[model samples]
Target: MSGWLAIAGLGPGDEALITPEVTEALAKATDVVGYIPYVARVAERPGLTLHASDNRVEIDRSRHALEMAEAGRRVVVVSSGDPGVFAMAAAIFEAVEVGPAAWRALDIRVLPGITAMLAAAARAGAPLGHDFCAINLSDNLKPWDLIERRLRLAAEADFAMAFYNPRSKSRPEGFAKALDTLRQACGDARPVIFARAVTTPEEEIRVVPLTEARPEMADMRTMVIVGSSRTRIITRDGGPIVYTPRSVPA
Candidate 1:
């Protein structure tokens, strides 16, 4: 078939941050599918169908996109931030792995975009400049105990951390536990950044010490970055810059 499927990242929020590659894929798409908000980002036009689904039905969404593509429709699955980073690309692959063998032969491509952590880091002056790890704080797919264990271990490693899905209405306590774990392991002096709605009109960046950070500061829209023990803060006329130095002692 002349059909193809492309999983594309729409970047954090700003239209300017969207890569040209993803933009071109959208322009050529016969069907655009994704979570409601991300799918809504695609402008409605003639001959382009938009399939916006709920947040939880990732496998169903992936399958719908694949079916459309196999039927000679050029389909694009749009994701906020990078698709590979805790997003739709992996879900699509999971569906492919379990589905009919024909899916393995379908033309598929992953078009990367600027993820939230990178956008958030740029706004806060490179808090992730050194060794860092990105963790999804929501334990929807995993156990809470495992999440807590990972948090403690990350702190012990002294790696800068960028967290996604820090808090949600259903699981408010997870982020609070994360804060407690960080405070105990990383101490109270390290910088903790709460970057909300990065690159959008509603964007807000706040850098506070671990002692001052409250779990309530973050929501589903926020990306939190906790500095390593060596991370520094530079106070300037404009605002404070948080960054990790590139070199370490031998």
Candidate 2:
């Protein structure tokens, strides 16, 4: 509303997921920009311009959003999940890598959203309550070798991992490779979770051993949680849940 480009988060699919700050910013925004599917989730917002695009054009989208803000538009760039964790925040910052001082001074505020990892972890109990880390399986921007190295380190360290951007039509085998590496360090039967769509309609939470995961379930919409050696899985109220056990007194 103040002619500053405020990049806000709309959280997950549910409207109740939106925070008060995000709602206020959206109400005052003259325009919003995000991936088409994510932008479509905001059904009640009216009297505002919306710019939606494919996920592949991330840099272009940020540049365009900022350009509109520079033209005195109250712009709100949105991300489906959280803006900071593997979302639009990085892209917008990347767009300003070689910007003018004035361009850098443009007001930009990022609001946090409920990411699929946190939502999935909550549904799956306290699997990530320990010293866990996250990794993206899609190697579009980063090479597979780098992913492989990280997976190797995570496996060696016995860290519980949340796998994001697991698979898509073009990149199918990244999960398999990561799983294979994990199996060598842990065991073939190590507990792993395949959580799909999260809070959305197509939610699927499957408790499968590391070796039992099929490539069919891995996709961009899915978030996979690989447990550490101390993690355990059980059924609770007809839902699969994972948790790391409390440490024993020495």
Rate residue 114 of model 2 by lDDT.
Answer: 85
Residues 1-250 of candidate 1 have per-residue lDDT tens digits of 4999999999999999999999999999999999999999999999999999999999999999999988899999999999999999999999999998889999999999999999999999988888999999999999988888888899999899999999999989999999988888886589999999999999999999999999899999999999998899999987899989997898
Tens-place lDDT digits, model 2, residues 128-204: 87878999888888999999999989988878899998887876777777777787777647778888888877888
Q: Give the TM-score of candidate 2.
A: 0.93
| Lowest lDDT block of 10, candidate 1 | 180-189
Show the lowest summed lDDT stretch of 10 residues, model 2: 241-250
* CA lDDT of every candidate: 0.94, 0.82
Error of 2 at 89 (Å): 0.5
Tell me model 1's lDDT, rounded to 2 decimals. Answer: 0.94
Runs in model 2 deviating more than 4 A are 44-46, 235-237, 246-250
Residue pairs in collision within model 1: none
